[model samples]
Target: MHDSIFIKSLFNTLYFVFIGTPFVIAFQLATALILNIEVKGINIFRTLYYLPYLVPMVASVIIWIIIFGHTGVVNQILGLVGLGPFDWIQNVHLIKPVIIAMGMWAAGSGILIFLAGLKGVPTHLYEVAKIDGAGPIKRFIHVTLPMITPTILFSVVMQSIAYFQMFTESYILNKGGPDYASTTYLVNTYNTAFRDFDFGLAMAQSWILFIIILIITLIVMRSSKSWVYYEAGNGR
Candidate 1:
């Protein structure tokens, strides 16, 4: 039973990160780009965009719980579309997507980081790209993206580590329920140690999670050299 739970939790954790990180990064980058635009009241817009990140994680989770529960706002919206209520946190296939959706609540921090990276990109580089006959898309690909690669790398590594140990939201929202569909590594460790009273097993699980995060982080760092560029002429 322990082995089965452990293996299942590990696979679920991996699946969550792999499926969620891209969406998180994309949304963060898109927000950053939109906010980077020079406009009146931009700071207020940025603050509003970041308001969700300012909320405590537990509070955010609670809000999401209410939103995803039966007869909640989400269901009401679906009802408008002639789709009946759907159980979000309980359904096996839908649970991970719900968790992934929850991650978007805190994506404001990533937007801030991406915006900082966008700001650091020198204006002259954009001018040079334009002079070289680069269109908007070409300029973004050749200049904007390469310049922001470090920020992207940082975001990926941080998000991967966080998602690998995802606990609070899953614990509070799903309790790793619906047949353990949401049992991430950290949740499994918690249950093993506290609920099952298997300190040794839980300790082993913790170490395994650590090693997994370390290996994945190292892989990201190593692979970054091929894509991440530094104006200082160093690759990652």
Candidate 2:
């Protein structure tokens, strides 16, 4: 029974981490890139983007439940466009997209970090690239990307850690419903510990999560030397 439980939990955790981490990283990086652009009203846009992150997690989950609930505001908007109401939370096919959308609501923190990295990029590099007749695309590829690789790597590590332990959204919103379509590893651990009073199993599951995260972090650090850059004066 112990081995079976451990294996089940491990598979669930791995599945959630594999699927969700990339989405979070991609969305945050894209948002960061867009916000890094020099444009008017950027401050306002930044604040608006980050507001969701400031909200209490429980409250944010509640708000999303209302928005994604069947016959909720989202469906109402769709109805206005002559589309039928869709069961976002209940539909197995849409569960991943719904979770991705919910995750995106709090992408501001990642964007902020990326913006800091963007600002830290040496202006001299961009100037040199411009002198070499590099277009915006080329400049971004050669200068912006290489310079910000460290930031991107850091964000991936952080986001992967967080996503591996995802529970609150699944708990509050779907309760791992729709035939366990949204059952994440953390949720399983939570259920085992709290609902089932399986403390031993829960602890085992938690340790598994810790080991997985540690391995992933080590992998990121190992891969960092390939792409992550540091200034010449700064000792890496």
TM-score per model over all chains = 0.97, 0.89
Question: Which residue segments of model 2 deviate by more than 4 Å?
Answer: 1-12, 233-236
lDDT of 1 by residue, 68-181 (tens): 999889999999999969999789999888889888868989999999999999999999999999999998998999999999999999999989978998899889878888
Name the weakest run of 10 consecutive residues (lDDT summed) in model 1.
Answer: 227-236
**Model 2 per-residue lDDT at 119:** 89
What are the Cα lDDT values of the candidates? 0.91, 0.81
lDDT of 2 by residue, 37-101 (tens): 78989888888999999999899988988988887899999999999699999887787678777
lDDT at 230, model 2? 76
Steric clashes per prediction: 0, 0
Q: What is candidate 1's local distance difference test score?
A: 0.91
